[model samples]
Target: MSVSPGIDRTTLRTTVAVLVGGIAVILDSTIVSVALHQLAQDLDVGVSTIQWVSTAYLLALGVVMPTVGWLQSRLGAKRLWLAALTVFLLGSVLCSFAWNADSLIAFRVVQGVGGGAMLPLMTTIVMQAAGGHNLGKLMSVVALPTAIGPILGPVIGGLILGVGDWRWLFWVNVPLCVAGILLAWRLIPADEPGRRVRLDIVGLLLLSPALVGLLFGLSNVAREGGFGHPDVLLPLVGGALLLTAFVLWALRRGGEALVDLAVLRSRPTWSATALLFLTGASLYGAMLLLPLYWQQVRGTDALGAGLLLIPQGVGSLVSRVVAARLLDKVSPRTVAVAGFALVGVATVPFALAGADTPIWLLLAALLVRGLGMGMVVIPLMAVAFVGLERPEVPHASILTRIAQQVGGSVGVALLAVILATAATSKGSITSAFDIAFWCATGFTALAVLLAFALPSRVGLDASAGGGTPATGAPPGPAADATEVGKRASIAS
Candidate 1:
């Protein structure tokens, strides 16, 4: 079979398999937001206690993410993927049966451990199989769940709660998990394991807690005292200290470290990390504002607000092919700059909108915004791996994931603070949303400036056997072996 300019048939199949499993994780992330209230009431716990169901999951995700590279190295991708799927499935079943908030929170942590590994590993395995080619196209496929999750998660959650019990939220993952495992077993190739690879225990110790503390602090920004609250300040400060220690420790350990801080030396890698941070802030921060703007200022219900967000999702889906084509033809820098610029321009309407602004106009802007976001995100994710080697791909994935996650948390916290402060001073809901949106626009505008640092071309040689550099040049011995395996799999 002939391959397209980007993804081939084998790569497409692999992407589908991973995405099928990944959809449950993506859906679960946002689906629970709408159910928090229902869960609080059903479980007979305070909203604060029920909130931990989400918090514990996030904390577990942070703890497990940095350990993925080490785990993959020891277990190999196929084995690790299967193991994580099973764990997540088990967690889902346990969560479905939880009789109280504590049990649910514990089960959710198990789910997070599985999800945290799966999220980045999904990209790692695919990029490895693709031989470093057609990343833009591949990412467009990978990004589908991310783009749709926020839009559809709440709707699905609401529907489940509307007619059925809250436990259905966890139960919903069972079929997807089972199917993902069966497909993975049948399709994904087995590889030689790094049996001699040793875990970086010190790095894991420092990095995991560091991420947990930081996320814990950021998660509390919505409480009564905001960032000044004791809950927020203590964890933030402690997390900062732990993170500082990890940086120093990782730097000292060099390539032997759990995360391989040395990967930042690659210009494309670091630039992508920076852009991911900004994009996360822009994407998630805006998400926080858009929903509230509709419900609070426009006086719509949650379901109504979710329906209105559909245009944005539609626009995102529409742009995937175009953006992927552009990335392959034009270059990541060009695509990313244009994307962020479009997003910045599109956000102006929201920044200036009043309480009575026309819904049609707002929806139109959201469509444009979604298109821009698609362009921005796909290229950034693709380029992060462009110049990296096969071994370096895992570290690159972890770094980008961390950047985006932390960036989203920071973005949400900052925007929440801005909204609170503005609402108090102005006593007008519309004005507060306007200010919050302006802050989100600022994030995208800054992202535009950083996008220039991305590679000006897609240089990775997909045809080269073994891990080829993004320079589209001859491959090294290790990359050659890697490429040989990928091609052999494809040919078979």
Candidate 2:
């Protein structure tokens, strides 16, 4: 089962297969961002109704993510993933045939359920197969969609919309899905299913509704004047209380509850999760700023704006190899602190750029910002797993992903609020853009503080995290409990 050293053939093949599938999910998630307007018109619905398409997908995804650890243990990775892919494909087909906004949004729920399962499962599968080694390089391979999605999704959506129709966006997923299924079948390992364990039905019900209500509250806050509105306040407060309840319930269960919160006691886990939130704020905040700045201030069309983003994507892709290598050799703290500093510095140019700023200069700033982004994402992810047990990896993966997704939503909402208020008083698109850029800079600066929380030095073993001493699992009815406990110990 040992993979050979230095990008072994089997590892490379498996990594590529997993990543190809990942690209489809990530791409589809973001592609709809650029197509919403077109979709509303084609379906003859108001923009408000069309908004449900993305929201439903996001809500469904968030609800399902925390369940992934249990699903993998019970269903096995291959079966769960293949079932997810089948659901997603069917959803895509349904979406393409939708005659109304409501139908499309409803179908997107199906897609989201499938999509939600795939992301964490992909991370769990790929990282586990790497045997808790070479996390940096493997993350780089996996990080492709995060970097490329912003570029590809918008551009592809714009191109397809310009030449044909909004349905083409869904159409694009077909070929990729087919290829992914085949590659997954051929390359992914088919381990025997694990023994059945008690499913936390109560914990899942509590968590999912809480997450949806929270996200809904936040979205409503963005829409209905302010957070003080009853619609916003009720759900937001209720959701927070529910989440708190889940936490208490989980802790009372002695860490065997849904999320395994005990793992947060691990310094690496806490630090990594914190950095994940900051990274989400910075990365997603900047993504919002660049495009709006181009279209609103510089008057670039959708395609032109997408073209301007190319340098940023290129910078991210180029940095991956270097960042991956540096992570294995350098201290995670040192790498992350420097990365945030670079991101903060790069934001200054955009914050100060005028409508007349030269294209080349803007592109250069994006390239620098993108490099910092890659550095932040890859290392933050790599350092988070350091000293984790194999079993805890899935839980950690789910938490990090959830944190980032929520952070992104917050970042976008905050920026939107800022831009809205600023535009009224500032009186110019450039002014709004500059104000938002400064906000983004602040987010990156905060990331530096979180980065310092990571281990000050590297080269730590996966099983050597600073926390409670390791303990074997309590006896369970299932035969696989021992195996699960060993894996969970490493991750915990």
Best by lDDT: 1
Candidate 1 lDDT, tens digit per residue, 104-182?
Answer: 9999999999999998888777777777777777889889888878678878877888899999998989999999999
Q: Evaluate model 2: give its TM-score.
A: 0.91
Return the clash pairs for model 2, or none: 387-462, 388-490, 389-490, 389-491, 391-487, 392-491
The 10-residue segment of model 2 with minimum total lDDT is 475-484
CA RMSD, predictions in order: 8.9, 8.5
Model 2 per-residue lDDT tens digits across residues 1-492: 454355556656777777777788888976777777677778888755777787788788878888887787777777777788878888998999998888899999999898989987777676666655667777787888888887787788778888997887898888888888888888876755554556787788888788887777655544536567786689778888888998888788754677767767778778888888778767776776677678767888877777889888888887787788787778878878887888899888998999888988989988988888888788777766677666676777787887787777666666666766666567776777788789989988888877888888765335422222211121111000111111111211
How many backbone overlaps does candidate 1 show? Answer: 6
* Best model number under TM-score: 1
Model 1 off-target regions past 4 Å?
A: 1-6, 460-492
| Backbone clash count, each prediction separately | 6, 6
Model 1 deviation from native, Cα RMSD in Å: 8.9
